[model samples]
Target: MKSRSQDTAIHALGIDFVELSADRVVMSMAVGPSTHQPAGILHGGASVLLAETAASIASEINIAEKNKYAAVGLEINANHLRSKRDGMVTATATPIHIGRRTMVWDIRITDESDQLICISRCTVAIVEKR
Candidate 1:
């Protein structure tokens, strides 16, 4: 599969898709000035964006290839656990539910030391392309 990091918002945020599969997706982003908040830590919104991106992409991949569908995020929530000052943070998204109309994913962001940085969940709506 082609990387989604070429020219999208993911690329703008310096997010790279490391692993993608039917059931799981992994992405990583560098913790630098661009991703930091005023307090000098990884921004919560950046983590949420990474979570949503992973879930949305995984949801799209889980759809039938023959079906013309688009996965759109209906809802998302994130809990910032720990603060990351530098290094890279990785997010892993796994399916919680995969239904015909909606999909739910659980995403976990971890620091380079494997410390939990954020936990998030995203719900995506699967709609047929017109």
Candidate 2:
């Protein structure tokens, strides 16, 4: 479980969760000064962070056993399709594969007007804490 203080990234980015089902998650965030690149568009790292965070949150919610299971990102690859300036972006994530020790997630990012912004794939390794 994470404290509210530890989840400041969501608040700092003004992110909202629209759909958070068992295996799928959809979130939106408004573009802010901190999220912009020097080119005046949304930063590439911000998009990747959004995808990574969404996938991690989905995995975290699936933890139900006595021992705490942590999802550590092992691999992530994302491609930027388009650029937007100062607008709300929505990200949707669903698990492509979930195994006992590894999970692969697919994420799609789109702007408020339904334009593709980025696509990402993330892999996480599950670890049990003693």
Candidate 3:
């Protein structure tokens, strides 16, 4: 499988893929200075980035023709459930709805101890490549 972590936000944020499939995508990012807010906690924006990346990648995998279609993020929302200081945070994204033009994904980010850190929903739009 081609790696998705090249010259993208995923690469900039240090996100590592744990699993990838049409139905689900799992990725991990370490909580460090790069991902930390000024308050020294994991930045909520970073969590949202992880969520949208997973959803967009999953939607792309569902596309019938990679050369003809592309998946782009249409909308995304994240709810921070908990805060983490340091360690790894893993994001798991699963499809809520897969459609002809749009795919919705539910993403949950959890800490190393399996505690929920954030929950997000992302809508990906499939567009014809021009």
Best by lDDT: 3
lDDT order of candidates, best first?
3, 1, 2
TM-score of each: 0.92, 0.88, 0.95
lDDT of each: 0.92, 0.84, 0.93
Clashes of 2: 0
> What tens-digit string does per-residue lDDT give for candidate 2 at 60-93?
6665652767877888999999998887999999
Task: Give the least accurate 10-residue stretch of model 3, judged by summed lDDT.
Answer: 1-10
Task: Provide backbone clash counts, one per model.
Answer: 0, 0, 0
Query: Highest TM-score among the candidates is held by which one?
Result: 3
Q: Relative to the unseen true structure, what is the C-alpha lDDT of residue 23 in candidate 2, on a scale of 0 to 100?
A: 91
* Superposed Cα deviation of residue 1, candidate 3 (Å): 13
**For model 2, the run of ten residues with the poorest summed lDDT:** 59-68
lDDT at position 51, candidate 1: 95
Candidate 3 segments exceeding 4 Å error: 1-4
The C-alpha local distance difference test score for the whole of candidate 1 amounts to 0.92
